[model samples]
Target: MSTERPRIVIAGGGLAGLSLSLALKQALGDAIEVAMCDPALKRDPHGDKRAYAIAASARRMLETLHIWDAVADKAQPIRDMVITDSRLQDPVRPTFLTFAGEVEEGEPFAHMVAGGDLTAALVESCRNAGVALMPTSVETFSAHPGGIDVVTNGGGITLRACLLVAADGARSRLREQAGISWISWPYRQSAIVATILHARDHEGRAVEHFLPAGPFAILPLKPETLPDGRIQHRSSIVWTERSEEVPHLLDAHTEDLLDELERRFGLQLGELSFETKPQAFPLSFGVARRFTAERLALLGDAAHVIHPIAGQGLNLGLHDAAALAEIVVEALRLGRDPGSADVLDDYERARRADITAMGLMTDGLNRLFSNDALPVRLVRDLGLGLVDRMPGLKKFFIREAAGLAGGTAPRLLRGEAL
Candidate 1:
């Protein structure tokens, strides 16, 4: 009905929000207006000491957006992965499964990138692409017949948009304001995340040790050379532990903490020391009852929060960005309302199954391995061993983990321009 370009307002500037803005602007040029609001955007991204595993498909989406090259040199390709299940006191932890890490020839399933680096790159890319970057966050919003009206808190700015996206994360205020019901439960486990500098190189290998408490992941990172010509190998640790035990671990003296870390890390990587202070995050599983309502849509943790057991949390959000971008771009190109119910429904349908499956899978895996029950341990280990022995099954899983197995993969994820 109207020939005016659609305005889309995103309520967060995290990875999902920033990437979505870049995708929309890069795809539609001046045909659409994209604005992202997040107070964190005003802060320096270098303070974030986290790292993420970027699936191959998500990497493709970033490449399509021309954002990957900025951080490519800093990314560490995961050449292989090893999984083991054992108790902390065990003298030897036997590997139950091993993955070659390549989903396609010469293409690793994933790469590890520092959070700050990726965020900085995305923010710069969004600005360079002409997407409006709002330093204030969306405090409230309401949908009207023509579009949605957004109100920013401290900025005192009221903006109108054809659509409003809630990327505010697991504790999304916008989702609540939109009357979206969220189902969630705490795992009573917290993951201690930190970067460790080791004497020997990791050789681009990632390892996951499933202990009675939870999965301890050692994700490889690109080696750093020191001033004295020493190569410093690094890895990002996601050590899951009982929730009540986290505070003690975090408050423990450096030597005490290092002792605990060494018990699980073993001597494979040589002496280990913290490259960053450890931070703990309480784990949880959450999903919205509906991904969209009228002109409102949920993205990233705003829609779902899955366990990081499989390291697929960020990948799922990137997939959402790609899918939503494609749907909106197509709808607008055809002269339809990008925020219309039909367009929103298309995005919901495309992502619902994938998100649900991943949520359930990670939840199940965490429950299965986060215990000392002999029966459960034997069963899961056997299952892992069996699957590890099946080349076809493992290959299929590799593709799935790379976010390239499904038929509904978006063009951006497929490394194609919108």
Candidate 2:
């Protein structure tokens, strides 16, 4: 290893990559160096229109890194959540399960945050923490005994680091180059995401309607105030539909789109109008055969991509960031190489089971609800109803969803320093 302070290079600057950089710098201070590269960092921070349900543990990690305060005002806490199963044409959709979102005295299980806002906050935090935010993409890298040599796409800037992390997202070129096998299968569904301006407040309530195609999620967002002094009650919609029908829906007339949205949205929020153009994302489930190899480690979508049925994808990535940061920080503080096979193996071991469980859970949920089979519906509905009646089980599920159930949670996730 280099005689100077060990450096870690992250090959993406998305949520996971940025968070990992911030976490390492915050914990290790001047003892270690962190650099992150992603072309998206050079683009407008507000370009992303998606919103995410950040679980309680992820919020704690952000708080520990001093990032939560920057975005807190814009985050809408999920005070409650309701789940229903019904067909699109059904006049009545009965709620099969309901949850009061708090997992602790006053801490809600999750908060809905706009992707752009959170990303901007994280970027700022990384800058303030002294992380080298390179506005370039990693073109290639080669791991040797001492460290990994990373070459950037722009100007062939070569960076030598103690470790190279691939956070470049689901279609990671680095993962492919490293010969990491990816097991994946596409879903028959795609999610239509958009912002909805409703006439009434959401009251921090989130609703998930499981239709024949897939689950339609209405997640609350902080109300927006216009310059005209009007407060616009807003919510984000994740409308999952069959993949074959996405193009027609996207190209549909405004009136036609509104009509289609209303069919699933109902009239509970009074009037509804588009706050932004709807966008569709094809859904898929995938996991890397291995999370680590040589001095290279995968994070976020580079490691796995799960169904969005539970809104846990981003949170899972955050978990990866926290866990990896903790492991690397601890190893470095002990005078061990942070990128060594032993250190990387510790990270992989710490994260694999959690990732596997979440993948299977989301996949099973999507499969069980995204169909109209009578037998399956009856069994699943009965299960939901039974769980709803059991307060203990309900609380357990809420804690698990909040990422607070496991005792082995990383220090950062528990709102602690390394």
Candidate lDDT (C-alpha), each: 0.93, 0.94
Give the per-residue lDDT of model 1 (tens digit) for 1-418: 3677779999999898898999999989998899999999789977677999999999998998998999999999999999999999999999999999899899999999999999999999999999999889899998977889999997689988999999999999999999999999999999999999998989999999999999999999999888999888999999999999999999999999999999999899999999999999999999999999979999999999999999999999999999999999999989899888988999999999999999999999899999799998899999999999999999999898899886769999999999
List the pairs of residues colliding in candidate 2.
none
In model 2, which runs have C-alpha deviations exceeding 4 angstroms?
A: none
Model 2: per-residue Cα lDDT over 217-335, one tens digit each: 99999998999999899999999999999999989999999999999998999899998999999999999999999899999999999999999999999999999999998898788
Q: TM-scores of all models? A: 0.99, 0.99
lDDT of 1: 0.93
The deviation in Å at residue 186 for candidate 2 is 0.7
Ten residues in sequence with the least summed lDDT for candidate 1: 1-10
